[model samples]
Target: MSRIGKQPVALPDGVTASVSGQTIEVKGPKATKSFTATDDVTLEVQDGVVVVTPRGKSKRARQQWGMTRTIVANLVHGAKDVFKKELEIRGVGYRAQMQGNTLKLNLGYSHDVDFDVPEGVTVTAPKPTELVVEGTDKQLVGQVAANIRDWRRPEPYKGKGIRYKGEYIFQKEGKKK
Candidate 1:
């Protein structure tokens, strides 16, 4: 049996969940999100709780059940509360700013890279070198943060560029004479 898959997902007040076909719809006070189950997984809602089960006694089905359940749980939680990702810009001349709904980054590039913030997601720069990404959807929030980080990933030599707050970068030594 799958430990995570067998766990019951509790529904918070003002949140509603329903299973139709292979789709699980969760509606909260703030927003609503739907997730589709894979071929080897099944989703069911009972008495205000959601359950995930494998379709058959196969290795693939077993593997998917737990993962599907976790995704569904995240969706439910996201509908109620926002998820956030924080990044810091290190090195001279590295900075970020918010222009309306777009994030403007200066990462040593000749031209600034402008990233558009999608609906339901907000990007804010508390300080020129600190950025915060907030949204209800976990996946979307994380993906956007990753995209920004990819624009100018931190280098080992100088530990410069964008990186998650408190993330450790292994510094490389200079070449031997």
Candidate 2:
């Protein structure tokens, strides 16, 4: 049995979850999110809580049990709260700024890199070196942050690049004289 899957997801005071067929829809004050489980798992809402169970004893069914439960829990939580990510740009000339819905990046490149913000996600630059990504959906927020970091990953030589706040870059020693 799955330990996490055994636990039902509790609905918040203002949140309500309804299951139709294999799809579970959760609505809260902030947003509404839904998830459709595979045939390997079954989902239901009972007594103000959402429960997930495996449809069979197979390995795939067992794996989907816990995974589906977590996804449902996330939906309930994310519906009411916003997920956030912080990024720090490191380099002498590297910086970031927002122009309307676009993110202008100067990552020591020949030309500036412009990233168009996607729907359902908000990207902000409080300081030239600091970036904040926020959204109701966790996956979209994280993906936006990752996409920005990929523009200029931290280098081992000088550790100059865009990286998550509090992230440590392993520095390498310089070549011998």
lDDT of 2 by residue, 87-148 (tens): 99999999999999999999999999999999999999999999999988888999999999
User: Model 1: residues >4 Å from true position, as ranges?
Assistant: none
* Candidate with the greatest lDDT versus the true structure: 2
Top candidate when judged by TM-score against the true structure = 2
TM per candidate: 0.93, 0.96
lDDT value, residue 151 of candidate 2: 99
The CA lDDT of each predicted structure is 0.91, 0.94
RMSD (CA, Å), candidate 1 to true, equals: 1.4
Off by over 4 Å in 2: none
lDDT of 1 by residue, 1-177 (tens): 899988988898889998889998999977899988889987888898888889999999999999998998898899898899999999899999999988999999899999998887899999999999999999999999999999999999999999999899999998999
